[model samples]
Target: MTIAALQTVPQQIETAAIAQVRPKILMVDDRWENLLATEKVLKPLKADIFKAASGNEALSLVLRHRFAIVLLDVQMPEMDGFETATLMQEHESMTGVPIIFVTALSKEEKYASRAAEIGAVDYIFKPINPDILKSKVKVYLDLYVQREQIMRLNATLSQSNEELERFAYICSHDMQEPVRMMNAFAGLLAENAEEAIDEDGRRYLSFILDNARRMQKMINDILTFSRVGREEILLEPVDCEAILRETLSEFEGVIQDSGAEVTYTPLPCVETSSTLVRVLFQNLIGNALKFQNGSQPPLIAVMAEKQGRYWRFSVKDNGIGIENGFRGRIFTIFQRLHRKEDYPGTGIGLSTCRKFIRLCGGEIDFTSAPGQGSTFHFTLPSGEAARPTRSGQQAC
Candidate 1:
């Protein structure tokens, strides 16, 4: 069957358009004749050439319009070019605008040198060569256009990502209520009709109920995965040792059943999302116990060691190690190594763990050999990278 929704989703996400507006150039000079001549030379370039008679006028114009480049005359009556440049530095928006100082060959050469010291990009001698001026200004204008395009593309991409995440969240949420109802109704039928229904009927109902529960779990996993992308990344100092302990508490039943021996050291505080941190630890620890080798108890150790600007964390486990062939695809969505009957899972744990680490500006990877066990590793920025919190003071 041909699906149309997937094909149209991308187009819908790209609803925001990027505008190709003309580049804006600001010209400041004391004499109208100079401004008029410069405007005539730049006319062929097809830009919005804005002329300012004084340095104060130029500053006011920049406040209203984002200029690609500023053409400033060194010798202005009230506010000289040097003072104007200094004042523009105060206005944050004018900082990046390339300034080309216009100096006549007849003027004092020291003004040119002074303009250079004042952060002017280039000096164009008076009796300005029209061709040279156009070409040089064109270079800056082209660069400005390219930078604007990048900003537009980034905005569009960020919006698209948010939309897709919201879509997944809505689908998973809507899918849950019906699946829960199915499981509940199936259970009721099985209980009330136990005497009337045959053994085969009971088995069929059990199969339906089991499959429904699995579907519910898969939907929940999808919700969890999508939720991370929607939530803002809160980078604050988080004590990894505390988070590890909390994560282990969640898997208490499984840890006891598997006779797992979990050990960890004083994991230092780091800049990270507290929620995703817990998810990362939970998945890694749960995977260790779930994929145990033979009947032997699982041995898991969590550690965090400082690595210059960031902290390198590792969860080493003695369990059924990953096969080399499956390493690359192990973190992919819905990709699993074992069957549902053997090792039950929605195949989203590793993928979600990777997503969580990425959102926190960190990376997660692992090393394993079949029967040799696996070691999952990741790195997060140290607390020094984040704003200091009073509660996160260097405490235990």
Candidate 2:
């Protein structure tokens, strides 16, 4: 597609127009001659320069305009550069704006240190070298421009991502109804026409019904993945043990029929989205049970440990483990290593688990042997180490 067409969907294109605007510069000094001299040195840079005769004027100008850099005179009447810088830091918008202290005062280490402490990017004495001043200002100016470009690009990229997710969600949701209808009709035909049709026809109808059901499941999985991306994450104190218990309960029948031995230590409460955490546990535990070693009962364990500022959780299972080469694409969506008859899944589970972990500012990975087992580990942000409500291992 053409670049223009790419930008047409989701939102209007504003980056190109905004990037063309010149970076603004604010020169603040008690004397107009100093401001004029500084402005002259910086003329080659071709920036929109604003002159302020005093700290008050500079603050006022900054409030009205976004400046790439501010050159403040250290010694100003009524309000000094240090005071102005401190005040500027208080304003959210001015947080990223860099300031340089221009002073004719003593070049004492203490003065420079004080300027540094007050958040001045640089401190310069009188008789400023035009080359050095211009070079330093140029560095900050280039950085400012690059920062703005990045911000704009990120905004554009985010808009595009949101649009794509919405489209996927809509498509997956809309496709489900037709797939369900197809499955239902195929089932009805199989039941009503079995006596009238040949064996080949019956087999063909079964294939159609099977495929329709599979397609519906795939669409449902896609919708689940899309919802993970679109949902707003609200962090709250969620009991890990409680979520795990609920997840295991959902698999109670499978655990019993497969002779799976599930156990977990006392998990702690973490600050994260409860729904997302539950999804994480559900996918991991389901994989543990589904991928059990041939004729070997599944032995699964869930455990958690407190790491600095994070809670590390591991779901270890004795199952048919991942191979060395396939590990790279193991988490890829729809990437199947086994036949549909052997392992029934859409291959969206692990990818979805990765997405959920990352959405919570966490990391997820696994280690496994080809035939032995696999252990999936992930970490979530823990605001404070939560005290476990109980101790000892619980098994089901």
Top model number, TM-score: 2
lDDT of each: 0.84, 0.85
Clashes within 3 Å, all models in order? 0, 0
TM-score of 2: 0.79
Candidate 1's C-alpha runs over 4 A off are 1-9, 12-19, 105-113, 191-203, 229-274, 291-299, 318-344, 354-362, 368-373, 380-395
* Global CA lDDT computed for model 2: 0.85
Write down the TM-score for model 1: 0.75
Cα error, candidate 2, residue 167 (Å): 1.8
Q: What residue runs in model 2 are displaced by over 4 Å at the alpha carbon?
A: 1-21, 30-33, 75-91, 229-274, 292-299, 305-311, 323-329, 332-342, 358-362, 380-396
Give residue 312's error in model 2 in angstroms. 3.7
* Candidate 1: residue 231 lDDT (0-100): 72
